[model samples]
Target: MKIPQKPNDLNEIFKNNIIKLMKLFEEKEVKEFIGEANNKYIHWDKLRRLKMPGNEKPDMIWALIKLSRMVTYRNIKFNKYVFNYSSLSEFQKRLHLLDKGMGGKILSNNGSVIISSQERERYILSSLMEEAIASSQLEGAVTTRKLAKEILRSNKKPKTYSEQMIMNGYITMQEIIKIKEKKLTKGLILKLHKSITKDTLKDKKYEDTFRDNNEVVVGDSIELDKIYHQPPNYKEIPKLIDELCEFVNNDEKEFIHPIIKGIILHFLIGYIHPFEDGNGRTARTLFYWYALTRGYWLFEFMAISRIILRSKVKYGMAYLYTETDDNDITYFIDYNLKCIEKAMRDMNSYIDRKQKEQTELLNIVKKIKNINLRQAELLKEAVKESEKPITISEVINTFGVAYDTARNDLLQLSKSGYLEKTKIQKKYLFRINKDKIITELK
Candidate 1:
């Protein structure tokens, strides 16, 4: 994409009469400059489309953006990167609601306000799997969700580059969960990169190593020279990374909201591009790491990647908006907040649908005296349209039960004629018998 044109110099516009800027700002049109969703935090690229001139031109919009910024870190002044809006607008407040919704109100297995430990574990596994699949897809890994999930659930070895990428994502996310309480360090960051890109990068030597050469550039394959971003120089990477860690570890300083700080960390990794490969994956993973570390526990189960994948062009544009417009970063923050909002909405909807399915299953299985909730849950999944044939390994992974327990659960269902069991290649697979299940319900 062509680089966005920079806004005209605001200094030149206000050089003669500084009060002219104030008078112009006081005008009714200026006061009423509320843009639509498309115009929210109007970047110069979009603002230039407006029919205004001189001081009232799109440069005025840039001026407004600058005016809106509230610097979070006073120490980083020259390239004042960390910032947010001076005041939260209604739009931002609504998005904050979504961020807060991570603390979901759903009842746990124990009928408590807090999630039961068992249910929380299940949500974490589901989240890890989702993030793995979606993060890999974002980085151009091609594989079906069904197959990727099966590979993870069965603990089968990954056979292809795409599958490896998915597995790497799963492993990296799990590692992040374990280390969430630890402070960020260069070593930990490198370890994460290694875990995410192992067996996937073309140059095996560069798996965990920060790029030591200036050859990295972000842009389209067709036009390599038309660089979208040239990250900080390789020579400066070590110091930059150290500074990033310090910033992330600073909790006692003038407080930056944890959610916003997490978004900033996500943007910084992309801006720095410390790795030769897996930068996007690492950046996204680090976003999760920061949120979880900062006590945004429910963020573990929200798949931001799925929301971002739906509008990748906008995702890229959010970065461009920040880079082109004085490194305000509010643009990127706004975009991420929107993604989190949508993700939380999606999570809530998923819970509602799953609860409905479970309720229906309970209603049907109430007549059967001996079955457990786990059995009923599996049966509910079996009746879904185009459901895949089940396996004991899948049951083990799904319910986090032991191998013996999962095997017995399926065996009991099969014996009751709710499932048809068959063996292929020494592995037992169970297919749902829809007619038998319906008859049992009747």
Candidate 2:
């Protein structure tokens, strides 16, 4: 008899991951990790409160979740590079493995390998993740080319034709820029989207290629790759994506931390495998965007994927441990939290050092007599931007007052002999004198 496909019956990955994570909330390690590190590295609190440039703070949460959906997808795509591939040459030869399980495509499991289907599901997820960049940024007019441009802007490289051919679900980075530069019409998005779909249709022609003559998947049917059970229907995936997108956007219920929610979103999305091609990437990116949208930047600053990528076994094991024993998503959440906590710890230390220095500067400012608020701040900026002193024009620009207002702020401290003025033509620049903060007031 054939083995059953899929590992479990749970429909939501987030629900499972979150359920597992709740136990650690009261632990000493968890407490030390969040409170002591406050507003430093894992600044989920800060991000939650942040004001997005063009939108309200709360509304930005959804946008961030959307953004994370894509970024998570990208991180996972690059991650597989470390495994599966023995060498770059081997990958270049066999990358066609990308299309097998895309769009609900599945193959029968055989011995050792899902040989016909190896890596196809993964590749499809990567393409879906790539689509997210455009989905979040451009909205209705998104095309494959537009999506490619979005990736190029973020990753800082142009896409080649081969790259576009491989990312059959979305536009190549090269084509995205082509549209932006006015070389391609807005209508081109329709053509490109259709073209990618058409290209993917050809994968059916090669189904046998991924399959052996035996009509079953080959290679290691290790615990990781075998259909934990039958992969779900294609239509069912979008529902999970929509539900998760909503969960991350929730504004009510403050006691449950937003950081927890972000991690939960990642777990649920990964488990759902909503997109045939880009589940892992989508999970990570949405995890990020979820945090970002929640104004959780201090925590988001850590780039969770970089942490997860640092050790694939731990990352995978975290999933396996939580996936089996129960429907608990706790392990996944805790692992992500720890990864974020570590990043925040690094950031917090840096912040604490800077803040300590800021305090010292403030004390020095206190010693200067007749030092107005502007000059005190100027001193602070001078120290922070120690590479150079603040220019009079910069002070004026920062304050949005008169040029003379800038000069006078500088002049008061200068007369106190607490500041030194440098001149170029008609303009003056100011620098703090040594011990000036101490000398000016007395």
Candidate 3:
């Protein structure tokens, strides 16, 4: 990504045309100027094209853009990096409203059914698989989603480097869930990095350690010379981290919205590039950590990285837009909020499809046999996909039934030819008996 051109100084631009600027302001062009800035809180380069016919001077446009920014602070101990953003605009207000509405839906009774309350473990596992795979893919890990899911589900050790990265991410996500309530600390951050980069980093020593000697750069992959960002010197890292933890711990002066605070935590880590490797993965993991900790239960089911991976270039541009234009974080915040909204939409679509299939399966099973509701639901899941294999423990977990009750449910299905049973080690695994199922259901 090429660096955004720095806007010309506002004072220098107006010095030669003070009278003309005054005239424009007095003529009620002040409203127009503010309106232009309000359109999208866009940077000067992008905002310049929207300039009115008579308002084409680059410097004047630049000055007006500068005047629009509202400074916000993210306190780091020794060297704080203050950011600025335009006050929330109409677009943001609508997005937040939509976001809040969606969040509410996911926490309601209907939401529980949509999420398969009886099979929450499965839903959570599926979400973890999707997030882990997509997050690794964002860092250039190469593996098909099908193959990755297979590897994770089968409990097989990862073979290739890419697969390992995906597995490491999966493990890290589970760990994040476990530790979400714990305070964010330097030690915890190190633990996350080590978990994610274990056996994956080329330089093993870099694991679990901040980059003290190595130089890190964010730039175009194809054109490495086009540097987009350079993080603070390593000497600043310890104090920076202290400040970061302070913010995370809520030992700060102001109250930032939980979602915004999480976004900033994500962006600041990437900007700092404190670690030599796994910075991206670590940054993303922190996002999940902070969000889940703040009681956004619906986030557990969101595959945000999948949405982000689809538009990785825009993801980079969001960061660059903030850094290059000024410390304005609105660009990055807006992008992430959109990503969350997209993820919610996808999640709803997934639930709708599953619900439809569940109904279809239940209807078919009811016609086939005098089965209980649990058995009917289980059959729907079994026949829906070859990937969904049932174990006694899962049935017990999903339906909150006793072990024997869950076992008998599957056992009865097996005896009735609705499912095939296989003994793997000591436990039984049941899957749809394809031949019997298709013939009977038809």
Best by TM-score: 1
Q: Tell me, what's the RMSD of every candidate?
A: 3.4, 22.7, 3.8
Q: Lowest summed lDDT over 10 consecutive residues: which window, candidate 3?
A: 69-78
Which number leads on lDDT?
A: 3
Instruction: Give each model's clash number.
Output: 0, 62, 1
Full ranking by lDDT: 3, 1, 2
**lDDT for residue 240 in candidate 3, whole number 0-100:** 92
Q: List per-prediction Cα lDDT, in the order shown.
A: 0.77, 0.43, 0.78
Give the TM-scores of the predictions, in the order they appear. 0.89, 0.35, 0.85
Q: Per-residue lDDT of 97-159 in model 3, one digit per residue for the tens?
A: 645753543433255555445566567778988999999999989989988977776556888
User: What is residue 383's positional error in candidate 3, in angstroms?
Assistant: 4.8
Among residues 3 or more apart in sequence or in different chains, the pairs in candidate 3 whose N, CA or C atoms overlap within 3 Å are 84-328
Summarize candidate 1's per-residue lDDT along 19-67 as a digit string, tens digits: 7667665666665563332246667677678765344656654565444
RMSD of 3: 3.8
Which regions of candidate 2 fall more than 4 Å away from where they truly are? 1-230, 251-255, 348-442
Q: Given candidate 3, what's the lDDT at residue 30?
A: 61
Which 10-residue window in model 1 sums to the lowest lDDT?
A: 71-80
Q: After superposition, how far is residue 46 of candidate 2 from its true place, in Å?
A: 37
Which of candidates 1 and 3 is the stronger one according to TM-score?
Answer: 1
